[model samples]
Target: MVTRKLAAVAAALLTGTLSLTACSTGSSGGGSSDPGDSQLNKVLKAGELRVAVLPDFPPWAVQKADGSFEGYEIDIAHELADSLGVKLKLVSTDGDSRLPMLQSNRVDVNVSAWTSTNERAQTAGFTIPYDAHGAGVLFKKGADITSYQDLAGKSVSVARGSTNDTILTNDFPSAKPVRFDAISDVISAVKTGKVDAALESSYTVAQAAKSDPELEAISNPPLDPQLVSMGVLPGDQVWINYLNNFIRNLIASGEDNKLHEKWLGEPLASIVSVQGNAA
Candidate 1:
């Protein structure tokens, strides 16, 4: 009996030792795997590129009556997926939802025309800028405002929670900022003369002006220019680099200019020009 008990105790000790060794091996294997391999490899393995986009932002992205998305960013998203030899899976998102979708891993990347700000850079990685624009005011063609300073003591419209709103509140505190939920609403307010002007991105303002004969977009002094980039989850250097290369290729091949002309009605601005290219 004593011999049998001793043998049982020895077997238990050996089993525990093997279990510990297996755990250690598994951990070491995981640690040794290249960090950069995971995100890009997972995307390739899935055979579909998931991208988040805003559907209501015209010229950048627009949702059609048929429920399909179209526009410059949509085309760009499709092209990126094509380059990966993967199907494009667009996850419809809004301005507020884009970053959350990326952080939660619901999408591999966000092509929502995000302005790369210092505060945003802290949370996510941004590829080299694909577009550059500044803030401007859109108003009726004969409106009194001629410069940013003219906004003083005037009622201006801005999308709530946007950089434009922040700019108005922080810089032009004297201006009465009428906040709206959508950029469309801000534009509408200005169009109907409910507001004297609407502060918005230069591209958006320009598009609005082109579409409406009574409206005009002006950026005389040019508010802070924003560099728009694709957003990926933080720490994905591999994915960021790939996107940067893809953007460079798009510029070199003239696809970027094509899209810009198709949507914005002009060749893409020199602001988007790559290092070696003449804008």
Candidate 2:
């Protein structure tokens, strides 16, 4: 059933025929308490929802050869636009551009695999978590790594400005860190032997390893697990609240689980849970 739903969604996206509601309506969790005072109103009145999304994060957001995007994050963005009864405009972003794009008003919201952090919270508003994942070490089969401690002296590739980059920087200072602007570049660094390993999302690591028999991802006891949410401009309490309610409705309708399974091929419970950043 989930596969069928995903197929339909994908088809709709490819054909630019997503079915949307007649108007934006908040969920039972408290429908936009300040709709007129935030980006929510602006988006609804404009009849379009501009969203920032990663163009290269596979399983989250991937740009196809045809220049169309389809992934878990893409689905979420589509759903949000659908609920608001608006046209969805996807603006491409990278790891470092999400917050900046929101701040510049180039996009209304960010759904680009954004992990919630206290530091980020100070600069942007995040809706309640809609997804979660943990970090893992991706290496070739014969690499010396077996545990986090093994990474101490090894060279690891990480996407610049990503949480994985922070982990390598703060937790394993002795390890050499190779920073790339895109997750694909980080993974390619590992595959091409430019780096000994890549620190990335466990799900992404798994997907990469699955596509390459020579690669392996060490995800047991996943590291630095994080909760993921949509990012909005700071102080947009009304927009933030509306997205939170939308996520609640997504969960209640079981659509979140269906989407998760379709993209990640596992139930949400199988993913590690974390308390988020200590700082």
Candidate 3:
């Protein structure tokens, strides 16, 4: 349990400045048209939902000093399980192993900062996105650098298989990109000047920047803005539809934004246009 004083410190420490991006995407899969089935029954029958989380990804999922999990996504997962009337079991995973954990059924859901993208969606379905996650570069404070083009000849760190990698690969193309096994590795590389700066998630990187006064997040945070989703076993129409509706209802009732504020410490207030396509 959290002592009130500590909780206040955490809440105060968590803050962000979100800039909305224009969302546009491919054609929506449309409705299940015929309303295929419900996956809620299977989940309820199991009596528990196993969720995989990246323990080091702060503001999303992280292991507390007490050796248990706590973070925005971790708390949200618990609430989701509660709503479903099932026990939510969390498994700590490294980011690289998240997909494998889901593939092997080691966990029923992957809620650890899993960004929804076109390629990933080919293998897995993401919930109708609740937020647009922007990326950023963490650099030594007062070093004076911003914008993707500034990375021209400098070595920039990025995580393997991350949207940041994809963006830098396509966007920079000229920078000597250093790929790491995890975000923590990339952050370390930047702090030690192993690389000029590291491409990382703005949300978590902001927390890192605050924690380490030596490092500060660069301006012009990358904004490809992928949709975040809960990953489940593929080909289960019942489960897909059920989760889709669950998200729809959550958005309808305003809990979706609440979850964002609760975990991220910023209301996800955006000039989001009502669009049919998945962003």
Model 1 segments more than 4 A misplaced: 1-37, 219-221, 276-279
Determine which window of 10 residues in candidate 2 has minimal summed lDDT: 270-279
TM-score of candidate 1 relative to the true fold: 0.80
**Which 10-residue window in model 3 sums to the lowest lDDT?**
15-24
Index of the highest-lDDT prediction: 2
lDDT of 1 by residue, 140-208 (tens): 998888899899999999977777888899989999999987777888999899999999877788889
Error of 3 at 135 (Å): 0.9
User: What does the lDDT read for residue 215 in candidate 3?
Assistant: 83
Give the winner by TM-score.
Answer: 2
Instruction: Give candidate 2's whole-model lDDT.
Output: 0.78
Q: Candidate 2 residues 1-279, lDDT tens each?
A: 112233234233334353322234333222233435467767767888999998878898998999899998899888888877679999999989887787677999999989998987766677878888889889999999888889888899999989999989999999999999988999999999999999998988999999999999885878988889898776655566567657766765667778889999976652322211110
Clashing pairs in 2: none
The TM-scores, one per candidate, come to 0.80, 0.84, 0.78
Across 1-279, the per-residue lDDT of candidate 3 in tens digits comes to: 111232222222222121112222222321121112223444566778788888777787778788899877887677667666678798987657766776666776777777888787776656666466878878887765766567777788988888888888888888888998777788889888898888878887788888898988865745577667777655544455445545555555566667778877786636321211222
Clashes of each: 0, 0, 2
Q: How close is candidate 3 to the true structure, as a TM-score?
A: 0.78
